[model samples]
Target chain A: MRAWESNIRKVVPYVPGEQPKGDRLIKLNTNENPYPPAPGVAEALKHMDIDRFRKYPDPTASDLVHALAEYYGVGDDQVFVGVGSDDVIAMSFLTFFNSEKPVLFPDVSYSFYKVWADLFAIPYETPALDANFCIHPEDYYRENGGVIFPNPNAPTGLLLSLEAVEDMIRHNQDVVVIVDEAYIDFGGKSALELIKKYENLLVVQTFSKSRSMAGMRIGFAIGHPDLIKALNDVKYSYNSYTMNMPSLILGTETVKDDVYFKETVQKIIDTREWSKTRLTELGFTFPDSMSNFIFASHNRVSAKELFEALKKQQIYVRYFDQPRLSNYLRISIGTREEMEALFAFLEKYLAQ
Target chain B: MRAWESNIRKVVPYVPGEQPKGDRLIKLNTNENPYPPAPGVAEALKHMDIDRFRKYPDPTASDLVHALAEYYGVGDDQVFVGVGSDDVIAMSFLTFFNSEKPVLFPDVSYSFYKVWADLFAIPYETPALDANFCIHPEDYYRENGGVIFPNPNAPTGLLLSLEAVEDMIRHNQDVVVIVDEAYIDFGGKSALELIKKYENLLVVQTFSKSRSMAGMRIGFAIGHPDLIKALNDVKYSYNSYTMNMPSLILGTETVKDDVYFKETVQKIIDTREWSKTRLTELGFTFPDSMSNFIFASHNRVSAKELFEALKKQQIYVRYFDQPRLSNYLRISIGTREEMEALFAFLEKYLAQ
Candidate 1:
């Protein structure tokens, strides 16, 4: 209808989770860390020399990549860093898929995959997840240019095991299989180790969730040298200085503080387990989750009604409008006190 | 030869200006601010509540857009903010130029323009600049889908007059014309006022130069509502959270402090004038620049030789390997003291 290209016009666009204003609510809509980043992150930021900002940040976040490589037990050449996991995924779409071949992903997976496909005019096929909302490796055996899926899938919070991931990669030898481990550190195993056997495997992770630096925007992918090179080429051709210096420093330091990372992730996993049991007692039916969030619903209480009730009680949670997810609420696991408040509010609201 | 998409496999990406590490050198290589940012900037950053970072930034950067719109005398809908001007330019390539038609730009202008064209696999033509290294409006009148050039263009620091810009817009009614005003606040007249009259015009600006927030990464574009919509479509489909919270805050405050901005611009202009007169007297053949940098060379001193000599004296300026620009060195205007240091070093180097 406008002067813009038809491909851009056709894009439905991905809508990110709402960021509500006001301090009146206990926010849990987006799956962000409930706790502050490691003390080292703030210390690193506080002492940053303002003069250094005058120079451009390193084009390739070299130090961050090296740190990531060390953490994941990979070579430095196997890593590619970007603004965030979203940027990494977008770059992957640009790098691996072209108009000639179709990219494959789960229909119920990250919504941005479809948006990127439409934006780049890349042909794509969305393989339907099984009836239990789990991706079957056999379903992705078709001739695809590439395959990508969130390890602990958003909105659902279900994780695929390492064996299942290996099966998909083994079946799709020609295509790149990207394991998006945005929330993997919370409970699941990363496919980073699988990269040694599968040349086309790219394991993507973010500091947003585990490191609790979402606002700082840092993410990276570890893969074979060739796969990393493809992503680097795409990134270089697009925007070279994607990650700023402060973010690189923060991310690098956060990765090195293994004590902080392990303690925080364990804390989230413990909270998630406790919350799941409590939700079960409240007559909620939800999938077993491996991420820092839980997806659940009850037949008696509508998802929208519960969301509104929580909002009224100063407790906020995410509710989707899509068909499969419309009746479910995706609640990000918060601190012990915050979860207690949520449970107390839910108990009162349900009794009423 | 790479395992990238065919378009990206052939991409010889643009190399950004050097951002050499360590504090030993007098850095004038990149046209960054010689002075530190507004005092409020660092203070604001220090006091930032790290807790607020858990939530995603406002995807639209609504408050920053509002402030920028107000400063530019336009509606919020007319503005589009991104990570930096580079991101804005990347989005523009997707939004404005279709692969069927060739985009046009000055041959000697910003190198990133061609890089974007190659990345997007869009056909492009480079119109030659005039003998004085200035953009000739008539040269862009050919049948093209879009045209872009930095006002007070980079490397050359030569500016096209506002009237000349209007002439190009008038002649090319059917194509998108992006006027990059990254250096306009330093001295050149802005084409922001022309956006209302010309539906195809998009004026891009950055907070990196005058505002001294290059490390923060914030840039924006102003245009008619429809053109802005096209850019938004592309941005939404690509990466939605391009601008982070700190950047939005830094950019908004920077624009709001009009007095600080004015004083900084005036000081830079004064220093540039003083430096230009000195260069002239010292037998340098420099372009009449409207930018924060000067383009100069001397018959007696080869640009490469001068560059090496300055390096030996622990000074840094940019030298290009491109044909026309090979003989010239682009020197960023620094503080009075820094300029004096540069002059002293130059005098000694030249005498030797």
Candidate 2:
């Protein structure tokens, strides 16, 4: 190893759910939407002026930002766009959490939080989630440099209520509070409504989920203009063209088609509800899920056994090997046909 | 304005040239390719499966990386792709220049270097270019944490010979030496040949200038497997899916068609050469430029005055208002008709 290598802070990165190659596998691991994006997105792609790529895309992505602002009913300056929610959150960590005190987050929330903190050498502490995999608003009331967590927490589709989120932000007024709503459109209300009440609140969301455009990598942040300005300062110092033209063009089209977005989201929510009842009858236990995925533990079969068994039959679901989550499986709500195939396998394997 | 704002290192970011909206003007501010990308790119965009965006893109970007490796005759592990060269160089700075020692670069080189240094808290020193705006290889022999400068440096377009570049890297063997080759294809040999011999050398290039894909935001860095590993480690920790699928798919098509790349680059070079002679005849003086853009100062008119005059006619070119560059204009070489129009305007204005 090179001597200079020591300068890099050691970090164990967060590994996302496996993206199975080819269409043979009934993939349901990463919470991708089961429906295609808005029809306008496809139409926009079809008629794209490919020659426009010869010039640089607008750094601010003004048209997309304006579309997002109009859709959300916020001021134009209140919105900020990036490559995806991952990028928006990473930039927020760099811009806001600079104090010597440790930042607070749920130990079982999105695992990328700690990775970013370690990468930037910022102090952070992950307070354990409650035994039921729910966030306790009181846990974040104490002093910290900043705070962040997914609303409908990953790997455990439990969402914190809007009132509880506001309580947490209200208590931590001195520091920035970033509420990641990557899955909010599935059911829960967004923290966007709370931004004006609390200046430090930043609500982060993405087109990767409800809008079904993860491959395009479009995400955004909504907050007070001052906070957006700070994020912009850091972003401009970093890569100015984080959002490419295709993402900006198609993302705007997707944002403008509210009817298609709502219809598709309602379908996923319905599918999630139906899957919850079927998994219960199959002897699985989980908190009531508010997201497109359900986090459940089989009453009889070990998660590892079920994970491997499904893989053998070309079905994919996320199984965590980490502590407190070893017995849990996060199953994304796929099309009705895909879910039916999953339960058919479960009925034979877990004869309980 | 805020108490925590003091923690962020204050920096004035590099402002890229304006991307004029509407097709009513002749655009050439940034050094973007003046021609459309290879025909394959348009074909790929036409046939792109918009429905494929339901899932996340491949994090590794295998196809594009392999294509780039094959084209450069390097192993796949020797290449690392990112959003753009700005991103590649920014990541390089964060990964390699972590030592307390100051890095070395030219004072009048790409202005983004200092902005990145300040943003990341890396100490850097800019040694003045020689009287003719040429990099003196001996100036880089001194001890520093790292070294990075464009081959044909920005705002000047004067190239340092490959031998001179090799000497600088050899002397600074302990530190990483990055050769920014954003304009190398216009008319300069690359430092890609030095990677196998020097493990610390990194050659950063972009499709923005050479391949006419600036709007897609594709750039790459080439080096030894060890250096690539270090960059990958930081990248995985930062954002795994840095390159979107459209870019990954379309960039591969561009790299495979080397003939189109050569034709477009040669066309720009010929236009640049002819433009240089005309500017010289009009009493404009500049070092011999081997890049797609020229850095020239006219004896008869102030650059700011000419910049406004050009803008009045909707002819755009980059004009820097910084120290020592206030009097110089960096004109991007556009199509033949566009350049002729520029000269036609200049001929009349200079006669005054």
TM-score (C-alpha) between model 1 and the true structure: 0.96
- Pairs clashing within candidate 1: none
Point to the candidate with the largest DockQ. 2
Poorly placed runs, candidate 2 (over 4 Å): A3-9, A13-16, B1-9
Candidate with top lDDT is 2
lDDT of predicted model 1: 0.83
lDDT, candidate 1, at B258:
84
Please, what are the lDDT tens digits per residue for candidate 2 over residues A1-352?
Answer: 6654544445564565577797778988888898888999899999999889998999989999999999999988999999889899998998888889889999998878988998889998888888898889998888889999998888788888999999999898888899999989888989999998998889999988888998999889999998888888889998889888898899999998999999999989988899989999999999888888999998888999999999999999998898999999889999999999999999988874
Please list all clashing residue pairs in model 2, or write none if there are none.
Answer: none
Q: What does each candidate score in C-alpha RMSD?
A: 2.0, 1.3
Tens digits of per-residue lDDT, candidate 1, B236-288, equal 88878877667777667778878877898899999999999988877798888
Query: What is each predicted model's overall lDDT from 0 to 1?
Result: 0.83, 0.89
Model 2: per-residue Cα lDDT over B25-140, one tens digit each: 88878988889989999999999988889889998899999999999999999999999999999989888888788999999998889888988889999999978888899998
* Interface quality of candidate 1 as DockQ: 0.50
